[model samples]
Target chain A: MDLTFTERENAFRAECRAWLERHVPKESLGSGDTREGFARHLEWERELFDAGWAAVSWPKEYGGREASLFEWLIFEEEYYRAGAPNRVTQNGIFLLAPTLFEFGTEEQKARILRPMARGDVTWGQGWSEPNAGSDLASLRSTARRVEGGWLLSGQKTWCTRGAFCDMAYGLFRTDPAQKRHHGLTYFMFPLHGEGVTVRGVDRLDGDEGFAELFLDELFVPDRDVIGEVNQGWYVAMATTSSERGLTLRSPGRFMATASRLVDLYGRYRASAEPALRDAVIDAWIDAEAYRWYTFQTVTHMVDGQDVGASSSLNKVFWSEMDVRTHETALALIGDRLELDIDHDAPESAGDAVDEGAWMRGFEFALAGPIYAGTNEIQRNIIAERVLGLPRK
Target chain B: MRFAFTEDQLLLRDTVRGLLARECPPDVVRSAWEARSGRAPSVWAKLAEAGVTAMTLSEASGGLGMDELDLALVLEEAGYAGLPDPLVETVAVGAPLLEAVGTAAQKERWLDAAAAGDALIAVGFEGQPFVPHAAVAAVALLHRGGDLYAVPREELPLEPQVSVDRSRPIARVDYAPDARHRVDAGDRAALDAAVGVAFDRAAWATSCVLLGLTRRMLDLAVQYAKDREQFGKPIGAQQAIKHHLATALIRQELARPLVYRAAWSLAHRDSVRDHGAHVSMAKVHAANAARHVAKTALQVHGAIGYTIEHDLHLFQKRAWALAAMYGDVGFHRARVGAATLPD
Candidate 1:
């Protein structure tokens, strides 16, 4: 029940704080929506890798520090505190890599994980198809067996960073005889392969950050099969669990946003309405709640305990918290919500301070409820799996 | 660096949960509530036998000398059982307050009796209305002018006030910290510190009370949703019913950490002021979880949940009672505001 970190933990924190103090970029990373911005972010991830900070919790053999979960949590807190650039390789590094650690063969690991950790390649998720948005298992995407490999042919929409990513990993129907979750297989392939076409989608960010991939018999070699064939559903759960749960949305982002919200609120609070003040207070407490809850979770993982239904509950909380926190900031900002990230409205240029990012954050928060297995789906999981409610 | 409880504490939780499940079932709780005294003395005795009351009291005072975190787990279990007894008030607020600030004679009189479950002591913080267990308690611990006091229940005139939760016997007492009964100490500073301990301990326990009740309520709701068929299928199959219960699950999950963190903060004495906000957050979220789950449970159950025969209202009323006690959501939110917000 202790909250105080050990001297060793404190020393680790000090080392991390010192490294971030020096390495964080001096300027914004330009939203990483542009190709140049993405490359810069990739270079920043490389810097992190060189310093053994890219995936602090990953095993050292895979090019990580092999830090404890608590250390990883601490690193994340310091990373956000120091205003470090966003990780352009998060999807590959956090989601896919854990599955790799769990199920990938030695040969696949030797070939993929090191380069993935080094940021030499970036990856995007290709799980959702045009007809399989929420009910992903009902996907019509097919992969027929070929000589020494499989051929992938289908459409994958809402592919985050799909417009430019070099690689993707997703589920494919491996056997036509079995249905639903039975006959699927996990596969990873080059996004720029012979039969793949990526078209940029108009996303809320007004950038080509998201794209739709059209696959015309894309050949994926047998070596790229992640887990056992006809068991992609099982393998994909590991990645989705990581996605919706803890790996991606570290407390650092929430803590940073919360502090910014408080600092922003303080500027106009003296003249603001009291309800608005209470709303800000509520927002702050929710962030603090998330922060402390993560500590407990890291403790559970460290103690070798299963988080169980908490992943679903955490998904509902942080997504909603993101929305509420952003809304409160927008309410305080009043009318600056119209400014885009590259806003050049001269009259407000001196004070913008990237009010546009907050606007962008508000839009992104809306996506939180929609993506990562929509909150409704998450709630069903909680109700059914966690609460033991009856399934339809 | 460990954030989770020790194996012993985990065992203590499981034991209390098991004891309450067998000895303090819903029927026993109802019987105790419906009885003339509206409290289960046997349940209180069972808890005292289980060492819940004596855990935080000093061994010199014939107690276990455990800490707040230890007792918090037991209190959470009690809340889960919706136990209709004054044990939580007796131990968390009464004994701790007595040991911290009561005169030597006061400790000899109440603390030992409380540890043995031979007596009950109700606490009434300043500005609070209903004094719980005042009807059955032998004494009352109150605060006024920043000083703590203990007066025999026989000395104060009490006007009986019926509570929605029948097991909680409440009343408005007619007494203002009489000097003769004042538990005197060094000076105003020591008095304030002791009062803070009593206040924080009681408020934090009330938060646990809400948490336990919320879990019970959510469980009941989920069970009913699974069995109650609507339009030829279980209601839980419907997205609306599942969503309602899921939201309740979310509230319970979010609030559980706040409660534990508050327990940890107060147990470690990590910044009295920050801990104040910590407990306040727990209190606020507990009330939110309890009230929200109660409402959602009723909605999911339709007419059946609204009946007195049903178990939902019992937990609902108890949750609301605990929430209204110490401080409601708005009260603690303001306390949190004072603690965290700048002047």
Candidate 2:
């Protein structure tokens, strides 16, 4: 029941706050999904890596501080509060790294993690395909055995930053005799490898945020296989849990957006609708509730409890909350929300009230529910797995 | 930062939950509906014997001297059982208010009796018109002109009011202000501060109760969905019913942590900044969660939940009653709105 941070935790918070205050870029970077934006974000990631702030929760051997989960959360809160650049390495760092740590071999860890942390390599997730989404186990990608490696041949769509990412990790069918979740193997391979083609897709924000990968006998060596063959479904479940739970969408991100919404409300209070005030307040409360909820979840994790199916609940809540928070911000900003305030424009530069950010944020928040397993899928998981409802 | 209940706190909650399961089941709640007293006194006595009635009282007052965090889970159990009593008023709000602001003479006379379960204290804040259990209380603490007055039940005139949840018998108390009835005669500033904190405690406790009631309603709906058959399968097999319950569970799961954090904030108010906002956040979230669960539970239950014979209505009604008690969702949201979006 102790809610206050320990003296040590508070000290860590102070250190993070000071570091973030000094190091956060004076100007916002472009969206990390684009090629140019991705390169710009790599610079920021390098700064974080150089300062040992890139992967605070990872082991020191992996170029991290080995910070406690609580410290990691504090770091996230401070990072978001400072309006720091979005983590371009989030796919590799938050989602893939946990699974890698759990399943990667000593050699694999040595070769992969440090470089990934340093932004020398960036990763994209290759889970969703054209025919496989909510029912992910039905993916048709195959990994036929070859000499010293496997030949992968399939199409992976909705690959986040796939057009520019150095590598990708995904599940592929390894046994033609088996179906569904069976006979699948987790594999990581370079996007520039032989017989691999990547096409960028324009997203809702009109950015090249997604990519479609066409693999025609792409070779991935045995050394790149993560976890045991045919057990990739179970291993990939761990990665999905990270994506759907605490690792990917921490409460600090929403809290930061909620705080910005409050400031926006303050600026528009005179002409804002009274109902908008309640929405703004509800957004703040939702963020605060999410923060405490994460704290409770983190406490349980620290106490040696597995998050398991409950991660579905977290995914559903925060995704919906993120959408509502941004929607509220857009509503408060009124007609100015229509303005396409270009970030690169000199007049809009350094302006705190960037109306376009809210629109862009709203577009981004809409994807929260769709990605990391759609809310519909997450709800079904919660119903059947968590609540023990009938699958039929 | 550990945001969880201690073993002792959980034990105390379990003890009360077990007592309520045995003594204040759905039948007991039903019995309170038509009973003249509108309460289960034996269950209250059992809770008092378990030291739940005096959990927040000072040690000198023959109590455990615990804080709101200790009583949170217990009050939640009370909400789960739909316990028809003034436990929140007497223990969580009234007794603590007296301990904080009552004079030496006042504490000497009522505190011991309150801790011993020999007396029931009903509280009515200024904004709220009806005082719950005022007719049955040993004393009624009425707010008047920013001051508090403790009038003996015998001296207080009460007009009984019918409520949607029959287990909660509320009344409007009519009492003239007098020097003898003034509980805050010692220090006006202290009384004002204590009264403010008392309201926060009331809201936080009520939110805990609402969460408990919500859990109860959701469980009932889930169980019923599993048992009832429709279109050749159990209704729970249907995605519509399953999704409804799942959504309700999500709301409850998220709201519970906020309520717990509010308990922590109230317990550490001296060191916590803007603690009232924390309480308001809990109240709003809990109230909304309870309301949503109640609606979804009824929807899942179909026609049975609408009937008075079903047990779901008992909890649903209790949730509705308590969701608006202390402060409704809108009221608490406004409080939060002011704090976060202040002019």
Candidate 3:
């Protein structure tokens, strides 16, 4: 077993490092989650896509470089290290794209993948209804079979990027007769379609990254169905796996942030209290461990190995790690931590980079533990499914 | 770039696991604790017959020359079994240290016997003077100011000291300054490198063993949870108990990759610079996993785990002792911190 990268991997690292160095923006895009900042973030996505750097893990035929998993990880590390803008199309690029590649029709692949890859259309996930957060199977959204299409009716809450995304894919109970994971279908429908209405969850920043969907007979053609009818459970499970697995939070993101945390520590190293120092150190250790752990996981995936239960384990671990890291960064900054800013802050309104990026990041990281699936649910998965314990 | 073990190494782990399950079950560990020797001779013989002791020894030293990863896998199984020998210290740390730095004659004298399973070898890092199993072992590896020495058992007087882990007989090796055979390990730089490799490998093995022990505790606790009923049902059904085991599983899963990767880095040797840092990281993470798992496992098992009548203490004690071996949590964490800082 070897830990060091091969010459080819090192070369890929060099290429990615060079590209990110050349293309990363000269100024911070205020807050990528905000409505005003998304255009610039989209521009960054176009820049990366134009350079053939975006979606490096997708097959080359699908507008990616067909890079190895390790190489893709290298790309992520370089992407985060260069302080590049966040991927505005993450939900589409990371989640829907992979699921589509796996289960999409040739026509579906032909029509959707390129635009998704090019950031022409953004996709938001439509899981987690008002009645269903952790108990996701309790969702009451329905899709009725029609002569020409399926008519969707119900509400989906916590739709990330819903206010802005062009489309969403979610599970709907196709047969009201069958309950609890049966007779359901996965379908993709446009948010701007005729019968759809969306209201952004009001926030101080007005970014409206998450929204609530109200559907009344939203028409989605049968061609928009993902996988078999009544098999949305399996398909949605795959999507959740993507949400938890390496696709969403790669080790590079943690490593890059952790490195920044270490640099921040160097700034406060002189008068830093031991408790603060330890928190900083804990952040670094966990981040480093996560990085190495991802490498091991990549090796396994590349060898066609399965990492069952570890997917949930990874979600719990890295999400919590992300929160701890951001918290430590905030604490280490001392009084600088007080500058909690929204986009309209005086500094944010100008050409200058706004401060409180860590604070913003810390606040956003709170969603990591809660979203995708809560840690409580993940722990249950580990206990019953992985450990062979009796189900509650 | 494979992080998983090869078939051969995996088979070695399985073989040892199967043998230990049959030969050295918890009952053997319990009985061995009460016995005077406490070494569990039959189980040691079975491990030796399986060639577990000779894994890290070089072919030139009358033994198979597997790398650190191979030996680490075997040691992990031994740990999972909670075997009471100094086998981890013997094969992973002691043999490898002598092979790397010992004089040809020094290896011929010490390595052959250790590999043959006719004798056990115990190691004493300078700071932690307790060489486990030193009492009835054939030899002792003791370190002083700047030199690492392999003194015969007859040369040094052993003062027996009881530890919380009854099966592991700890001792204070009473060695005077002028009394030992100095195995020539070149200059200060060479000696330091040898010592560093030995200590790090030992620490890495100790962490792997601790991980194994913690997993055993987790397994035992989970089984008991399924069997022992409370509240008119199996307590395992309770969210409190499920969450307990779940958190333990998380800690183990998280620490596992670090342990294996550190083993890989150590096995890779010259291919990686400053590999000791990974070893320390593994030690620190594994120690934390062990601590969390043991405490939670005991809580899940309730009163039964608190008694010596049950076998939970066997693994719990070994985990706590092994965490303190080489260096404890704070020491290794500080080492990692020091490694991180820019010099």
DockQ of each: 0.73, 0.84, 0.65
lDDT of 2 by residue, A169-237 (tens): 999999989989999999998889678999999998867989999999998889999999888999998
Per candidate, chain B TM-score? 0.96, 0.97, 0.96
What's the TM-score of every candidate structure? 0.96, 0.98, 0.96
DockQ order, best first, reads: 2, 1, 3
For candidate 1, write residues B1-343 as lDDT tens digits.
Answer: 6667888998999999998998888998888677836677677778778888787788988999887788777888888898888756788878877887888888888888888888888988888887878878878888766767788878877998888787878899867668878896678898887777678878899888888999899889888888888799998999899899899988887888888889988887745448888888888888888899889989998999989999888899988888877877787888887866666
Considering every candidate listed, which one attains the maximal DockQ? 2
Candidate 1's residue-wise lDDT over A1-392, tens digit each? 77888887899899999999998988777766556678878889889999999998887888888788888888988998898988889899989999999999999888888789888988999999988988999988889999999999889888888787899999989898998988999999888959999987868777678889899999999999998999999999999999988897988888888878787787768666878888888887888788788888888988888987678889889999999999988888777667666623323444555577788889888999988899999998988898888788
C-alpha lDDT of residue B297 in model 2: 95
Off by over 4 Å in 2: A341-353
lDDT, residue A95, candidate 3: 87
Cα RMSD (Å) between model 2 and the true structure?
Answer: 1.5
Candidate 2 or 1, higher DockQ: 2
Of 1 and 3, the candidate ranking higher by DockQ = 1
Index of the highest-TM-score prediction: 2
TM-score for the second chain in candidate 3?
0.96
How much is the lDDT of residue B60 in candidate 2?
73
